[model samples]
Target: MSSSYAGQQIAFLTQHGKEQVIAPILEPALGCVIKHVTGFDTDQLGTFTRDIRRPGSQLDAARRKARIGMELSGLSLGMASEGSFDLDPFAGMFPWNIELLVLIDDRLGIEVVGMAQGPGHSSHVQASDWPAVESFAAGVGFPDHHLVLRPQDQDDTRVHKGVSDWTGLKASFEQCLAQSGNRQVFVETDLRAFANPSRMQHIEQAAQDLLKRLQSCCPECASPGYWVSERQPGLPCSVCGRPTSGYLTEVWKCGRCLHTSVQTRTDCAFAEPKHCASCNP
Candidate 1:
């Protein structure tokens, strides 16, 4: 049950330390060598701060990044990762992080994408002065993790990012505050893969997901990237035997071919009445 890319070369485009987490997972699973493209300016395609805002949705950005790596490395296969941080989707009370890793194989004319989510994984705080920065740093798991310093009100040209030590962060904060014209320094957890351990953890999971999908083949077309794409909700309420909005089946599909299959959810055979449309109504 090996993937189609067992012996292929994959070009990974990144400046951050993505290789540390992604390489191990991909190499063992796909039996492929992950080459990092050195000179390509990935930030030109897009950035978190919207300096060079993304061309399209997250998927499009990831695909474009994959293509860029392939073109630069002269390899037909490529890989890239993108991350987004915001309020948690399932739990609105905390911050969360979402990471997506995409694999593109031009030779096969197929693309496989994987997603990972971490709730309460990222946070940001603003500090106006040196004392304020020290307090903020302790709150966001700094020193052990890194932080990014910028202007609070607007983007600053001289930003000090990837700051991990007290001396460096303090200097950056003082310098930026003096020149901010607004009297505040913006300090945030460096969400980059290398700087944030929580983010790195999620990225590793995403790599595993991509490998699993690539390993699966479509039953009908024998194409790679065959895995669960959707879920059908109709599990009967446990108490009332009425259909609920809970997922009852997992729908598998192929990236290169229009093939699909459905299976029952692994954890539960029935849904709760609290989620049942008929039972609750």
Candidate 2:
């Protein structure tokens, strides 16, 4: 296989329409062509709405999706993305979206995973009427942002989704309120890449990270993808010199070879005295 992806075509497995957001970042970085695979039912693999729950970790799911795209496109290289939303992976108060991008090269037998997290606002709301719905929608960037609505009635399974227009919004709002037995309507953000600009930015960042890693070469084995796989935690307290629960070094490894390298953490050199167990306890 060639070292870089220049002039190579990569298939992207996504039925939720992710090509526009992912392509702009990946094409220039990797110098590759990105084609969307339309035949695959990516929703069947997993859904953000709780049906057909994603079967594996973000990285694993991305790899599987990438493989499917490659097989369909008859290309040796594939690229895919997966995302999840939660109450912040780092320190925060509101929910956040975490997106992962995967690049698979069958010829080289290498898988590169890049991940990024973006601020998430509540995509959900409970509204009883059009007035309430309008107010709620405004908060979630209505008209410009899409939404999915489900009736809250225990017996109602009908879901009104992909709503973006005022007409559709009014109709779905009335339908949901009537069918919900006066119960609230469950409104959530339509997390599709095209619908959410924040998610698109997250995917773009992940693609850039993947490309940066691809540009690196292992010093020992000379692999094209050489970057940190993990980090070691144990920065010493500046005064006490006792190990503290902070990043000490990053462990960089080559994707193609088993070569590894460790370098001191760039963000910090010493743990605060208050963070040290010996100094604080």
Candidate 3:
């Protein structure tokens, strides 16, 4: 638990109870105290329901949030988390969640990011009747995971979010259905960390990743957050010994000094013949 940040106070930007997931993991590992900063509306940056489009990339949003927290709390170090959900790139069918945790050290002029991506529960349905809404709710793990209801017409800005109980959901659905000209309500799983258990798990995993990167100091400059900066692809095909589109080198770099070292992939030595252009094409 001994770390350079031991006994330091780090401001965390969150109003959705993310500190419950992030603080416990980071406090014990980094020996730093997490001070939750509130009154700053994080949804101004973006929202899960697409009410306000995020201005920049996921990393940029996280950095901005951290800076806001630091400025509000008058602290040098700050932390923030951002999450995105989409179709799994490889799986193609399942939902994927990418959670990113950022640590901004203004005193050191360095930013560290911890990331985790895996299967997630993020889906939507449109229903006009109670039975249809109930079936959709059960499919998405209702009660345990919350839902958001709105008119099926995208032009309708009125939204009922964080519907966890059956009674609340039913009421929201009826209201949305009544409001909609098409008599249909759009329902989606609530992606907020406090309402969704799956999203919270991913956030916790990202916190663990952040702890590991924080502990790994650069060999050249002794700076915290030395991590893989680049990936060099060209693993040799096992049969023809020709290069393939697989990672062969991982470039680890120091954030402060910019010193870098190349390390070979220990998990893989050769690429499959099917992945080789010469072998396949």
Model 3 pairs whose backbones collide: none
Of candidates 3 and 1, the better by lDDT: 3
Q: Pick the candidate with the highest lDDT.
A: 3
lDDT of 3 by residue, 118-171 (tens): 888899887889998899899888999999899975446898988999999988
Count of clashing residue pairs in every prediction? 0, 0, 0
For residues 1-281, write the lDDT of model 1, one tens digit per residue: 66577787899999988988999988987789899887988879876654667777788888888888888899999999988878877758787888899999787778889889876346666667687778877977788678888875546666677798988987788778887867877777777778888888999999988888888888888888888889888888999898788889999987777777789987988887778877677
Candidate 2 clashes: the total is 0
Off by over 4 Å in 2: 1-3, 90-93, 153-155, 266-268
Candidate 2 lDDT by residue in tens digits, 1-281: 22578888888888766787778876876678898887888888887777667886888888888989999999998889998888875686677988888888887778877778878644677766678778888887777778888888423458776898989988887788777856788787787777777777888788777777778878876666788889888999999898998889899998787788889987778999999989998
- The lDDT, on a scale of 0 to 1, for candidate 2 is 0.80
2 or 3: which has the higher TM-score? 3
lDDT of each: 0.82, 0.80, 0.90
The RMSD of every model to the true structure, in order and in angstroms, is 2.0, 2.5, 1.6
